[model samples]
Target: MAGFLSSWPWENLGKYKYLLCGPVVAKVLYSRMEEGTFKEDWCFHISILFAVRVFHHLFWSSFSNMLFLMPDRRINHQGYDFKQIDKEWDWDNFLILQALIASMACCLFPTFLESIPLWSTKGLVTVMILHVAISEPLYYWVHRCLHRNKYLFTHHHSVKHCSPVLHPFTAANVTFLESLLVTAIIGIPILGSCVMGYGARSAIYGYVLVFDFLRCLGHCNVEIVPHQPFQTLPFLRYLISTPTYHELHHKEMDTNFCLFMPLYDAAWKTLNSKSWELHKKIRSSAGKEERVPVPDFVFLAHMVDISAAMHAPFVWRTYASFPYTMRVLALLGWPITFVITMMMWAWANTFLISCYNLRTKLFETWAVPRLGFQYFLPFAKEGINHHIEDAILRADQLGVKVISLAALNKNEALNGGGTLFVDKHRDLKVRVVHGNTLTAAVILHEIPTDVKEVFLTGATSKLGRAIALYLCRRRVRVLMLTLSTERFQKIQKEAPQDCQNYLVQVTKYQAARNCKTWIVGKWITPREQSWAPPGAHFHQFVVPPILPFRRDCTYGDLAAMRLPDDAQGLGSCEYTMDRGVVHACHAGGVVHLLEGWTHHEVGAIDVDRIDLVWNAAMKHGLKPVSSSVTEQQES
Candidate 1:
């Protein structure tokens, strides 16, 4: 029976499992449509209860992520992986069942049908007393029993225990049987208050909210509550459970079995002795010496579009878990993201987006709260640079070894490929890297060694110029597509005298009609792509990759590389790249830190260092993605 009740009926429904709530939704709609029904109908109450609980859960989820951004406050240094995220994805299913039970109770009980007052002092007192006398003791004993009984532990309690590192969602990551027992434990206090004729709407709402809030707080994995409170009133440690206390339970089971209160654990002598000491240590580390460990490397990035903003970890965890792709449903979030974008423009600063560990080093990604289009706005340039500069300064102050500027943050027209800050703050100890040296390396290495000629677009840009010069030196004929003769000649002169003849100037796409190799640095229309001959492959560094017009021609993704096997705790994908893969620029920064290079890699790419950077990246176990020439056969 326990095994049968362990899993939810809709567990196999996948994303469509929300359809299970159709009946309650229809009930609410029916009640609203009936003109004779009161505004506060039972169905309306159920709907409101469900919505409020969901909102409460989301609040904790988001708030905990905010705390997670501050690494010093984290209790467990070890991070969670995608499997744990998948396991906890359906944590809210139990809430749906609870709502259905509420609807059933409202239908069956005549006493529950009576109009309840907003607030009742007697009801509040009764709930507190019942919770202390009934819920806590019952849960404590049942919880202990679940651990002691092999069958219960294996079939029921083990679900929650699977996640050693807890997140806010872990609070509800339990089997259906355990969820039912939890519901009953929570229901006793409220139902008891009603039986005593002291129940009120406020008491019900307040108790449920407090219960959920504490559960989430305990599992949040960050030690938020200070040790000062317990220091002043030592008994408070037994009255309220902290994140560190609960963490100890997950770490060393068979102890700290009390729910919300350690008082019961104390009475049973089940509380771990190190709980208080560990909590104090975490608090003291964050408070007294202020020893927040600095990240070894930082990849500073910005949003590409509204859809990209939705992929932020805090915004939508499930959406971010998979590789990002433009979807029709993503358009629905435009209004919400637009408002957030505007608000960020006015008030926000640089913030941590995600992080991971590679061997002994810690790497973090930080975001400037601006979208891609904003980088081109003339008025926004100063503000964007200011944010970028601030982030660089913060990284330097924190003793970061390498900080890489990504995407538009390294635009030549804006901050001169991060040169502005490096030149202005010459005394800065942190090495500022544009990381375009490896960007050019990744793009250059994608061209087949046998291909004698390649047509290039955005021919005069930073990456474009570097590729042109490098290819010319290889004696590979380059069709540089640009009308600016002076700019074309400038790049041509940078090559060795003998190879200068290989850099051919072209003004139109018609020149590349016969060339089977097309390097696209600029966005091209379908008309431009039509000029490419059949079987031509387009190697690109363009942001928001161009549309594939010809069926015969293949297009490559932006330059990226897969991290080494030693990389750990990478739970989310990087933009549209697959899991464990990162943009070439991000990989460049990691290689810079690992190589212990002290020079700031900003401004123009040194054609000399292109092979050096590529070789160094390979030496460090960073594998090029399939889009690179080395992996072309597999791709």
Candidate 2:
């Protein structure tokens, strides 16, 4: 807990510096509104100022999106998927809607705070108190009613819910009616403040700006705010809504209806069920590398697109990039070109093309900020060369030395455990890693020493096979689960004689439920249907597993992996209290950074070199968080 506050590891100071733009632009508008400045029409002045506010809000929202850095879900769990709303139109629509609302408020509302007054301390305190007193119940019921009415929700309220994975712009995506209700709740209070002669324009603007920032933060996917205040003081949590508080609301929709304060939600018994556990995890994970800023490293990833057709971004970019004469010719010949391209691709494809920029930014985590850029590529199983080509170009664009392939990217690039892509892309200036080696290494490092036997799922898959071989070498008997008996037999025959017979095939996950350690290397269909034994550890390696793991079993994946004592094995990476050992894929990137290249063959998964890699991480300032998994893997 002490370590959480000892240092703040945010690295992307470039974005927050935009906050200054708000006030600077506001001052310019305020001067124009005064007697001697350009046209003393208060209405006109206020209208422009409203536009400025809308622009400022949009700027901040876009800035946050561009600097897509946040606490890794492995450290602090996140509810939103960053990739879902990456289209440029989504942002433009949000900004346009909010700007329209802001214009109305500035032009039509008679209660605009026009006069700047010296703040009296007592008056400020009174305003804060009155704000909650006036806004809470009004907002609470309005929010609840919006949800209760099917017509209102379907037509207006649901637009905001379109982004179940919340972002800053999500806070502004509400319908005009909902926005008006919010405005009225806020307006009446400021109108009263003016009637009492206590309204100071500076104080009002300050409060509004603060509210805007908090609202943006509440929707941010990252959870960095500490829950210590709620834990130590007890009453503070009810008063202030954390990002996780609102996130649970988006996730469940029935609970947590508070605007900024959680007081009403607490009193009404609408707080989320998982809020406490989630908050504890949030506060304790502050020191994770995801929360810190690593200047040199940036993670670029994409969700696996399983579609057969090439994504439209490539077509759009190609058409827009042509010279005027070529553009006209292409437009005239578009039907033929489209048909030819599709037919050729259907037969054989060579290059991957970009579909959209899902997230592009410098990420700030506990250690330092890394350049994090993510894009969507439609070529998941087909068009292998195109995918690899775009990856190289994107990495080069960011000047990143290494690029981590995620989901289908890993699947296609590695040929499901082969290094053909690396061999083919030998001329790429940057290193490409499948990121499976470190993940496998971390899972191997975390297995309990006392466990004599383990259950291995996805036994025929690339990752599963590697784990089976590694476990066999360690003399730990493995009960392997695979759909293909022939593949398992082939792997078994390759094992050392002493452990060859130790490997046994299991047909069902339920059959292996009693095994003490279950390594889920790939998704088994109808997953999470059979639960692991009560005390067993379930290590999940696949992303978006076929189904969520059963809740009762211990989550022994990277989110819970800890470091060894005294940071002996961790290299130069920074440590966190709750989340100790970072994800092995992340740690692998750090290892490459320290060594200046991919020392091992890229795209291959192995656990034999776990110690060397772990030591490399520790030497570079990485430390272990958990004392239990500290022992070196036995030879």
Could you say which candidate leads in lDDT?
A: 1
What 10-residue stretch in candidate 2 is worst by lDDT?
366-375
lDDT value, residue 14 of candidate 2: 34
lDDT of candidates 1 onward, in order: 0.87, 0.55
Residue 25, model 2: lDDT of: 48
Give the Cα error of residue 503 in candidate 1, in Å.
Answer: 1.0
RMSD of 1: 2.6
List model 1 lDDT by residue over 156-199, tens digit each: 88888898578888989888888899999999999999888899
Q: Model 2: per-residue lDDT, tens digit, 1-635?
A: 22212111222343353343354345457667665574433444444555665655655543343323343432223222223343112332333333344445444653443443646555566568777897877788888887877767776577687764566667865554566566677666555676687776555556666667788778765665777777789888777777788778888888988888888877888878787678777667665654433334433333222121111122222222221123343465456555755565465422222111111222222100111112223433344535555545555454656655544445633254325656665666567665565566666667876678888877776667767888888888898987788989998987888879878898877777668688877665545436567776677676543454556656553422333333211111121213234455655665665566644335545556655666676666555433435554323
**The candidate that achieves the highest TM-score relative to the unseen native structure:** 1
Off by over 4 Å in 2: 1-55, 60-298, 304-380, 383-385, 393-400, 412-418, 524-531, 545-552, 559-582, 597-600, 623-635
